[model samples]
Target: MAKKKFPLAHVYRLLEPGPVVLVTTAHAGRTNIMAMSWHMMIDFEPPIVGCVVSDRSHTFGILRKTKECVINIPTVDMVKKVVGIGSTSGRSVDKFKRFALTPGAASYVKAPLIEECYANLECTLIDTRGAARYNLFILKVHKAWVRPLGKIVRTIHHCGRGRFRVDGSMITVPSTIK
Candidate 1:
């Protein structure tokens, strides 16, 4: 039997509607953050998250070594910084310093959370097989913190190619009487 091959763009589009995530990692004394829209929550009991990171990315190395990361959820105002982080590499420059981002200490992991973000989820890598083979890392979320003030702001959603959309008005569904 033969397997079907698909274009990268087509594969990416399938992963659309993925929330933008800031993959933060630290090893030794250096730390870095990268923007990724290819992330999703896979489990609920232990609160697991799956994120795709290129094997060649510097963050991948740090995550591999530390086995921990912080998924920072940014607001619509952070679109510029999100795009900037995605464009640059942490190996060449300190992304936090280069982008003027503040890092706050995490409660359970060595990886620091982006202070300016709307929400932060500290996680520890529990599965590495996917990362090695498909550049996908599965993390078990240890804790989550949300900013009260930032919650009012719209969430930033990526639409590929530097394009983004802010979260719109909310709609509530009423429960049917049993």
Candidate 2:
């Protein structure tokens, strides 16, 4: 039997239910935003979230120290900005200034919410073990804000690499037992 080798782009495309996430962090009065696709909801009772931030990312350092962050969910219109933020480092330049984005203070976290995003989730670090081991952080969502129009707007979904897909029509599933 022969094993086939594939690139990460190809492998990531197979991951279903992908959502583009914008991670916000603040330190020393400086706030930054970084795009991420490696995020997901973990629990409902306490509203937990999981996100992967590389050890070298500037946001990682801020998050580690502040123990708080905001997860902003953007619409398809922000795909370009999302990719741009992910490609650059916050230490070099201010992403909000460079990208002309507005920052709004979060209700529960020090990290500011991105004004252009469709939704924002304020989170506080629940554990640092995963962050130290796998560059993963588990956060407990404290509060969330959603744009009035965001409910009707489509969101960008990452398919890995530079290819991103937009959210399509929604369908409500009925319970079989009901």
Candidate 3:
């Protein structure tokens, strides 16, 4: 068997940690949504999450100022809308109206939950130490919402270059840690 060398620039595409999420933020009187794929779970208890939001993005400024946001997990069925949201900026356009997505009130945050997503996590900004150096923000989830088990759908994982991989069959494995 032979293995070919992969480009260093594309390495991140191969190591995407989780499903693409639509991060919603609200400040002053407006709401915005930014599609994010560079996020990962940092802890189990209290559900800490760390995500990178480029400083240049509109959501970055709002999140920094408000210290609140909703991480909405969309499914494979919304691939087109996810891609469109990622490409468009929330600076000039209203993503909710442009994409025809419903926004529901979040119990713990000013940001609205994307009703079309399978799950919505209401989070508060916990730390910003990495924001200046890496554009990273640490979040603590205060509340979460999800559809009934029977209604849940497979999530979509970004693989760079406008390509995505959908969640597939599950394989159970024995584990002592929980």
Score every model by TM-score.
0.88, 0.90, 0.96
How displaced is residue 124 in candidate 2, in Å? 0.3
By TM-score, the better pick of 1 and 3 is 3
lDDT of 1 by residue, 1-178 (tens): 9988878776765556656878899988999999888888798878898888998889888888899999999888788888899999999989999889999999999999999998899999899899768999899999999988632568877766776777867666897942
Clashing pairs in 2: none
What lDDT does each candidate get?
0.86, 0.87, 0.93
What order do candidates take by TM-score, descending?
3, 2, 1
Worst lDDT run of 10 residues, candidate 1, spans 10-19
Best by TM-score: 3
Q: Cα miss at 45, model 1 (Å)? A: 2.5
Best by lDDT: 3
| Ranking 1 against 2 by lDDT, winner | 2
Best of the two (2, 3) by lDDT: 3
**Candidates 1 and 2 compared by TM-score, better number:** 2
- The CA lDDT at 69 in model 3 is 98
Give the per-residue lDDT of model 3 (tens digit) for 5-73. Answer: 999999999897799999999988899999999999999989999999999899999999999999999
Candidate 1 runs further than 4 Å off: 1-11, 150-152, 175-178
- For model 2, the run of ten residues with the poorest summed lDDT: 9-18
User: What is the alpha-carbon lDDT for the whole of candidate 3?
Assistant: 0.93
